[model samples]
Target: MHDDGHGPGPARRQDQGAARHEHGHSHHRAHSPSHEGARAAGRLRHRLAHLLTPHSHESADRLDPALEASARGLRALWVSLAVLGATAAVQAVVVVLSGSVALLGDTVHNTADALTAVPLGIAFLLGRRAANRRFTYGYGRAEDLAGLAIVLTIGASAAFAGWTAFERLLSPRPVEHVPAVAVAALVGFAGNEWVARYRIRVGRSIGSAALVADGLHARTDGFTSLAVLAGAGGSALGWQAADPVVGLAITAAIALMLRDAAREVLRRVMDAVDPALVDRAERALSAVEGVHGVGELRLRWIGHRLRAEVAVVVDGEATVRQAHAIAVDAEHALLHAVPRLTAALVHADPAPVAGQADPHLALAHHARV
Candidate 1:
């Protein structure tokens, strides 16, 4: 409920004073940093500036936010894919040496993962291209398409794995060189865990949701690797059917993840904003002083960031300059509250209206031309 620009900490009092002055009159007053509250706000801004300095260049590119997101996503995908390829080659060798059906299935899955890297990498690089007349939104959605393809590839791999496991389960076979299978699985587990950790860290730092999703995918594989290891170990202990059962379990897990990813990618492609995020944005906007209310709050996801457009109702008695300043303050406050917000359009309303008040209707009425 607090309407302070610097957040709801001790800075509320100073912010309230500034808001009162800004809303009451057109007089400009220099902000004095003496208030503990003002100093706290200054510090927060400084820290945020430092954290976002690297992204500044990307933000300035004039390229669509989605495109920038794709570039970062592809870079992460390429690196993870390379690691997967190397792991798959090693896994294939182990499969051949141990003659383990489970190991072979894992090798195939890894190869499938590596194959997805090709399209994902291409999509990232191509998605960043400047928008042509034919594609005004640029190729940002290419990344979402690429993500959908990756999910499909994973689903297919999982299905194949399940089929292979079912066959192995029906007709059990003796696995050769159980020790070798175990060793290979252990190596794979360690390698995948490392890759997953690195990818997750980098993905978060870059604010690339696709990369974060991919990292989660890699981490799931790591868990699968552990499952494979357990099966191979069990097979060594006279439980020959354990390997196939574990494979089926892994396949099921992958299928579930694929389903979730598919839903997320579809939503992204359709530009759906998270309902929770929309609600949070509404709260932030409504909290700004001089804003009697908020309406027509529309939010869209552009890659990892959000684009928002809202109407802010101010007192009808306020001057045009006062209303514009209130709108500007609301813009700043909303962006500060929502870091992922790339841009916002704040339409100022003369008074609060209820029951289907169209902000755009107000705009049409106020046009000078």
Candidate 2:
């Protein structure tokens, strides 16, 4: 589980060979040349496709190297902050020149987006702390808390945008210097799109839900900027109410973004993972030599890293040492098969015989608790 790379190493192969020999299972069917070739090809295809696809928070696997995920997350926040800050500055200048209320609100929105990086950056720093007796899991949950903050920020942005648009609708204002406003809107869109793509890519690579949510927020801001640009065009044609109407539409869009962001963060908080990952883990466990069946498998994310707890059924007559070897082999298979899986705890259970008592009943009370 602590290996530096994904594939099985020399030590792992040795252990697997020993376990397979002890179990007396033939390697012919499972380890044929064609089967190994297919598996390798499948892994390569997955890696290539993973680079382009933006997986959901539940579905994405962490790709950063050991102890480097937090560093990457922090880098993404700083870069996003810088880009968004400059974008807001340019929009602010246009706000003053045009006296356009809609443009001014967008500038403020962009500024707020830039400031969001502060909480996420702090969370990334906190995630790097080593575990102690008091916090056995370390401060990884801080990243989840940061994700909540980002969700709240998105909610606030939606509310503010809606209110501004409502007020403007009540008292429509003439937007002056339409040309300047249009140019600023384009600048805002370009800056936000770039930041969005960067943050999302890094976030997926590191499996940081907070970072991805922040990226989605930036995308919403980009759409808002485009809405402003559209309004500016309408104003140039002497339509005074166009800005507020477009602002209202942007607010609706923000609401949708808020929903998706909230769902991802809440799922993370709830320890929800994609069922496909669970199936993959089960298959890995079942393939381990001497494992009769996979009893139970559980995977959860702790701050961008994955940990597993599993139970595997082995021969009822096997001694403790043989069972332990089987468990070790199962753990090794899991680490190789599942991406971002840093640790696994495997429990070996004896397979039931026809008339034997249930071994699991010894822990029935614990399960109820």
After TM-score superposition, the amount by which residue 199's alpha carbon in candidate 2 deviates from its true location, in angstroms, is 0.8
Tell me the TM-score of model 2: 0.82
Best by TM-score: 2
Per-candidate TM-scores read 0.72, 0.82
In terms of lDDT, model 1 sits at 0.69
Q: Please, what are the lDDT tens digits per residue for candidate 2 over residues 39-154? A: 46755775687688844221113333646788888888999999999999999998888877677767877888899999999988887776677886667888899999888887
**Which parts of model 2 have CA positions greater than 4 angstroms off?**
1-64
Candidate-wise lDDT, in order: 0.69, 0.80
Clash number for model 1? Answer: 0
List pairs with backbone clashes in candidate 2: none
The residue pairs that clash in candidate 1, if any, are none
What are the clash counts of all predictions, listed in order?
A: 0, 0
